[model samples]
Target: MVNSDSPTTPLDSPLARKNPLTMENFHKFEKASNGTTDSMTAPSATISSTSFNSASLECASKETSTIQNETLKKRRNSAGHKKDYNQTLFENIDYLGCSKLNDPSNEPEMLDLMRVLDEQRMTSAVTVSLAVPHSARGFVVLRDTTGIELTSFPVQRIRFCVRGRLDSAQKHCFSISFTHHGINGEQTHQCHVFRSAQPEMAGRALYCFSQAFSNSGKENMSDNEKRIDYKFEAYLEIRENEGSQSSPHWVLCPQQNNTLKLRRDRQKRLIVQLKQVQLCKVFGPPLTVTKCFGMLLAAGRNLRHSDMQLLELESMGPGANPSVYVINAIWDPRIHVFDVLNTETPRDSRVFLTVAADVIIAEAGEPIRFRLEAKARVFHRDERFYKLPRVALREGYSLTLEV
Candidate 1:
């Protein structure tokens, strides 16, 4: 139950086991002689050094392998029976609203969790409750059926996902992880492991958390500010008048497998990506105009650069592919602007977090100007123009960009 992104690798915990001949010590350590000798070159025991070393290696290998096999077997068999701290944490939570695992055995242990939270809540006024968007507040349970109140945290603080698959693998168990912020601002990560066979319960619990997060999005804008959602429809409307004789184009490199393909839609598109673009961060600053839609998603915006954990997932699409619209991107090779190169990613283990950006032609309010300010004058003024839509900016909203 250590507070960390990844816990002990699955089935690696030191649990009680039934071994036939229990040695005084479960592990063997080969020590170097009383000097600076190599660890492998242990003192010659009885026979030739070479024979003795080989025998030791074989014996050690057998011992370690046997232990690993038995440990894994025991852990897999006692899935729901291990009543460790993680199990207690999982069994006691009042997720979103409803109780998660209301086992009778949990009645006694709930006191410890509540006492710890009560102490923390008394630390200072700030510690009384989690500071999240207004929609996600007041989730703590001071008293419950278990005769003890459970500590609550905003659903926005969690990074999690559930299996959308309808297979045996959907065990109604998903991981809930969060970084515990200590009293003095220290950080410790924790991921709760689910062992109970409550597939339906687990799915519903995850849904509640995700739904709460979905409602408390980043677009919680102020009275004067505006948030815009973009739909990149222009991807399908590159060229409508061209006939069937004109085919899509491809630019392939001579040796490498790198290739770029472009396709045009037969209908008209009102919005597409603009060649002039800027990159913005989620937690860094305030933006005057449209924020990356990913900033509005909990998992996307909460992912910290310092965190190393990754959630491996497969897209539910036919081939788990990136969006087909990326093929319609217009990039300037001369300026090093590039498009997303859709490649064959049969197995990528890195967590695939996305921030969906839409291209919009901002037609009003000074055209959202941007430029490079440099002491060294530009050698070439390679300026480019963007043809924005004819529509005027909304009456109360303004388009803005940061460079």
Candidate 2:
């Protein structure tokens, strides 16, 4: 790198012609000058012929200093902008559901139905839940504030891009473009721009959506690693909705499959008795009983323990059996207990889960035991996973996501 603070030699000067202007030659010049310009001011009789033009040297020195000052100012501004960009991104971490399946943070992480600005058309405000089954794709269910299901669809494709400023009133912004496939085989294209009080939240959401496109089983797995299998037992209970004062809560049961069949209380909640969970290693998606049930179960458990707070699942399409609703969990809030948010990365490093399955009530009173297994390889929350995007030129300055 060039040091603009250093003086430059005149092109016609003998010193500039005799030696290359490398750091070593520059240091020699400094040493020969006795580390001071005092000699340049000495009487002409005392001045040596070996010295170059003193007037030219002084001009060059002034010019160098001015350049150095400008460079320093640019660097400072760039740093400030980068800091704001990162802050904007992390401020919305909870809304994006960026938690890894094995994360352990307990901070409430939920996607605020009101905060999402869908600009294509305005409809009555409704709450929505997102989920990811073993397929690793998005499954979204929209509901009213009262929790009545409105509509559900799968996100087929998504594109994330940065936009340029068009006028003095505009700034560089991030955008998310996605296509949602409805139950009737219809597709809807949606685009949302994030440049509000907290734009990083939109970026975080984009990162999570992109994870669905990554290789399902190969993205996290390294070659030569052996798959491990394990099992455990747990119980489930339905907390019936009573009244506004009675908040629903889960009831823990003891003993795995103790002849406790699945039953629904007055609120239409199904309580299951699951036990003897085991791990399974396979190549296909985890939507079936034999494939990725273990991974899906692990993800569900992780949601409770991780940093994410919102939960959603895929619902049956119109005219489908309302009696048996196939609920497939998608982008739920989860925290990676083993790691903290990679706020330093140029782009946020949120883990996307690849396993998904249906919450089906096959038999009212069947014994439930989950075999803990992952269809995809376990993802390591290490430094190598961090991502850094390239800087882009905007107006007069360059914008970068990293410092």
Candidate 3:
């Protein structure tokens, strides 16, 4: 056998151009192979058992080496494989993009909701209740206000392309689009847009809350990781109805203007209330709501105790069943913001919810509209609501209905 590590002169090498394949070299190689074959096929019976054992061990070692070499080759080939840059990307976060209209002929009767959510009022917090009474279904947008009458139109379809613009002031932008029953027929699709100075504010809060809510599952994580582009999201309820009956308190739809003018005192209180909403979202503990026995149970996102003012799952009301007479609105003004507990993610997080107050209940299989009085966030406050959609459990919410 030749020593692989030993250096050989070009003249003596078999691969040398000077020594190309020749009859002599071929004969020598053929003889060597024949000898090896004969040796393998016929064993020497006269040899001692010790020699036989040694031969068997040598053969075993060669087989193992071949297997090791084959495995190494496989690993090396795998390492050289190219990555697929064109692979589809899956989104783990909620829809944080703005919706673009394909056609505007069909429009949603949206409220000049932004009139109430001005720059000064953004500071005030509104308490939101879900599954309430006598309400309409529509989404609100928190964009830079036009400083005039609100713009409302029926929507056809919503596409996922978050194209945003900042005015000369360079503020973030946002909007609201939802799926609802068309004013005309089954083929008709409509959405509503609201007027505001800070459109993206609501979405930002919702996204922030989603991150925190999902992270809550992994207890004891560092807070530093949570700080991304999000500001905050906490609570809010919204919906559309009866041509959205009793929507005047919060939204200013086109037809309602002649009959319903916003009261000065109500707007003033809302400003203050919206400001308090900011406080609760930042300093207050997270409200973790669970679904058990056809009811949403509220608790801290974590297992730890939390501040009062907000009710626990054992105590959170607007409960599985509420008084129909008083609790009959998507955004009922009768309930105080504080008593309602949550607000639209006024710079608050929504975790697993959307800005379209009406869309939320419908997709949740509840089919109800939620209205906000002051807590920038708005949600319905009733348990047994209209349309009665199949309660869709999403985000991290459990589908299991515990008895």
Candidate 4:
């Protein structure tokens, strides 16, 4: 038996140094002892050992790097996470019909119509009664000054009586005229009244009569003309010759120039009235209508429970300065002086205006003087003017202008 452990020669010293060595000197000895004269010529064995050392070092470095990155990622995620209880509550709760929450102040208010009217005149009265039905069939009667019977000439004496269902959803209309008719051997003119949506009152009904006419030429009648013309004169009694009926008749007359009036009689009701107006200038130019109108610059603040009115605007470009138009505005009490430019950013930019602020206008046209200072700052003031079309919106109240 050979004693492999015993150091018999100097060549065995190299083998002993290579075995069970520390990591620092292992690479040094492995490189030094490789491809030597006294050592074995095992090139494949040397290559395998070198490759294993390099691979082990690479794996260890990568593992250390992964561990450090995981630790950093956890720290970052934890630091960024914050529990917002308000946001969480909003998310958890369902708000299907939550429009009232956004604008609680705009709720409709009850209104009393009779309280606004003055009923002072009771003597020498004109009593007009209108029987209106839910199914759109109705009639209006105008009593005479003595309140005895329907007038002989109802159309000439009585004005129009417009009656409809008290409810806001119904539609009704009425009209009347006079036409000539022959009864028995006498020729006379009769009145006709037309009612809409009522089959019973859809046709023309008798209303009044016309007067008589006399022939001017009778001496120039020849024998042929005498056979055809018998010089007959017929007089139409304007007041008499009428048939009485129990059914109610609607009295209509020519409307006076400015005597008609409208009365609103319900709570939370909407009334639309039309009036004729003569105007020289009409719609103002919209921002989209003309691009060369130029730019509008505005600065103002928005406060809670208040309207931000734009006072002044600086218009730029040639000719007359364009008007400043308000596009859209809202008040946020939490944010102050928020940059109007970057309001849609992901992170909240605390840009808002303080209470009671005025904007400076630096161009021509009418100098804007605002009443409310708390209104939200208008972006496109000219656009606002364009949106609310009609000259009435631009100028307050009503007046007759002749042009």
Best by lDDT: 2
Find the candidate with the highest TM-score and give its number: 1
Candidate 1 per-residue lDDT over residues 1-403, each given as its tens digit: 2112333321121211221111111111101011111111111111112211111100010011111112322323544322111101234322211111122112111222222222332221110111122222213122234443223333333433332122434243333443333334344333332322455554544444433444432333342223332221211112222223256342211111111111222221111222221233322232223311211111122444332122112111111222322212222212211111121222222122222222222333332321111010011112221342322111112244333
Clashes of each: 3, 36, 83, 20
| C-alpha lDDT of candidate 4 relative to the true structure | 0.19
Model 2 segments beyond 4 Å from truth? 1-136, 141-150, 159-175, 178-197, 215-228, 231-403
As a TM-score, model 3 comes out at 0.15
lDDT of 4 by residue, 1-403 (tens): 1122332321133432344212223233323323321111101001112211110000000011111111222323443322111110001110000000111111110001010100111211123222211111111232223443221111121111111122321112122211111222221111111223332121111111100001112322223433211111111000110123343231111112211111111011111111112232342222111112111222244444233322222232222322322311222221333335213322222222222212222321323222221112222211211222111111121321111
Mark the regions of model 1 whose C-alpha exceeds 4 Å error after superposition: 1-134, 138-147, 161-170, 183-186, 194-198, 217-403
> After superposition, which runs of candidate 4 have C-alpha atoms over 4 Å from their true positions?
1-126, 129-180, 185-306, 315-341, 347-403
Q: lDDT order of candidates, best first?
A: 2, 1, 3, 4
What local distance difference test score does each model get? 0.24, 0.25, 0.22, 0.19
Worst 10 residues of 1 by lDDT: 54-63
After best superposition, candidate 3 residue 71: deviation in angstroms? Answer: 70
Q: What TM-score would each prediction reach against the true structure?
A: 0.22, 0.21, 0.15, 0.16
- lDDT of residue 2 for candidate 1: 19
Task: Write candidate 2's Cα lDDT for 1-403 as tens digits.
Answer: 1112223212223453565433234234423423121101110011111121110000000111111111222423443212111111122111110111110111111011112222211331122332321222333333334554333323222322222122312122233333323334343322323332333333333344334334233222322233322232322332223333367443221112121111122121222222223244422112222211211333222344233332333232212422212222322112342222111222222222222232332221232323221111122222121232211111111111110
In model 1, what are the clashing residue pairs, if there are any?
4-189, 172-199, 236-265
